[model samples]
Target: MIVGGAIFQLCWVVRDIAVAQQAFTEQYGVADWFSIPDVHFGTESAELRGVPTDYTISVALGYAGGQQLELIEPRDGVSLYSEQLERIGPGLHHAAWVPDDYDAALTEACAAGIEIVARGRFDDIGMEFAYLDGGSIGSYIELMRLSEEMKAMFDHLIPAGFTNPWQ
Candidate 1:
């Protein structure tokens, strides 16, 4: 899972991770940016376009005002994030959600015809997440599983500014 808080992060697809992180910090005064480079979804289990493909992406997380902002840079492969970046350039990619029941949420989403575009797991932290096509709501809704470590990290993501995230 990428984030653990109730108010999930807003993701932006960017071409450069360092540039985006710097922009967020300089333009919005968002600090404590936690970054991960080269996150790969393993083959066989994780499918991209219905086939096991090697997809890698880099991410930076920081709190702006009271909201969480994530900047994602697609590295190598063909995931939905990469596709969005290629089709529309860098912009708002998705809004994430951490549900109470992973399987139940997925089942409910499927029942509503909210298809799972991409799902992956990172065994290193027992973390897994899925990107659900927002059926009627529009865009993509990312559902992430909550890990203990992630929960701990998310606890620090509080209201950073006296005003709002955009400030």
Candidate 2:
């Protein structure tokens, strides 16, 4: 249990965000989808396998009960999301945990020989995340660190622009 936190989010990588959102909404009954479009991770903001890389993606976040559901569509450049979509098509990609002690959890995971496949930060939102190779597990595991401001924003995410279709 390297992550060692309650899983709060589930993410799927898709070819088309709008199609994925509609299917998820209809099938899972997610209340609303909050779109975060054209998220750019500059070379300074992200890394792939410890090498700085630039990429773009669009994400839609929704809620079903306490769990947050996410749909990610790669827009440009190379990333784990795009690679997974190419290798496996579309389906569950990762489960995420926000540990109470983010740094400690990350340190421990690294100390335990877990491979960090990707990592990035949204500086404007004071948030960072890492994707860990799950090894024997089929899907990757994500660890997220969110600032208080980011947490507050996430609390009201659904209401900010509810039902925002992909763009």
Candidate 3:
């Protein structure tokens, strides 16, 4: 299995994003949350276990150290967040890895028994991401194919004077 990239994001499914983001900011000192609401996965473009669905969710992102802490709240529909919250309560959902070689990283994750659970394209950013269910570990792993546009956007969020991650 390919194993060079490091985990970049820690995602959680929360019952109330507004409250959760506040809690995280206060408790962990992870401030400056960038809120993104009504994330739309087109009717035919998004899928869960191969079944298409027009699921939407709200998300708030904050950087803790060098890793992103994402808090997600399920909207008025059935979605990955909804299912996870129903079965496991509001807690850690997935950890994302931004790999240089997206295809090879996916192949390695799959070879290690991480099965694709949900996938969709973010048309606005021209990037695609997939969530793999890390079966035995009982958590999910998201593999994001970082496009140039996505990189540029995230780079802007770098903390303080450490704008360069490579430094």
Could you say which candidate leads in TM-score?
2
Clashing pairs in 1: 64-165
Error of 1 at 41 (Å): 1.8
TM per candidate: 0.84, 0.91, 0.90
Window of ten residues with lowest summed lDDT in model 1: 158-167
lDDT of model 1, residue 18: 95
1 against 2, candidate with superior lDDT? 2
Tens digit per residue, CA lDDT, model 1, 28-117:
898778888997776955876457777888988888766778988999888888898878888888888777777888888778776788
lDDT tens digits, residue span 1-167, model 2: 56554576899999999999998888988868899899999999999999999999999998876667899999999999999988989989999988887888889899999998999998888999999898899899998888888777667764443421111
Candidate RMSDs in order: 4.7, 5.0, 1.9
In model 1, the number of clashes is: 1
| Preferred candidate (TM-score higher): 1 or 3 | 3
- Which candidate ranks first by lDDT, i.e. highest? 2
Candidate 1 vs 3: which has more lDDT: 3
Order the numbered candidates by lDDT, best leading.
2, 3, 1
Clashing pairs in 2: none
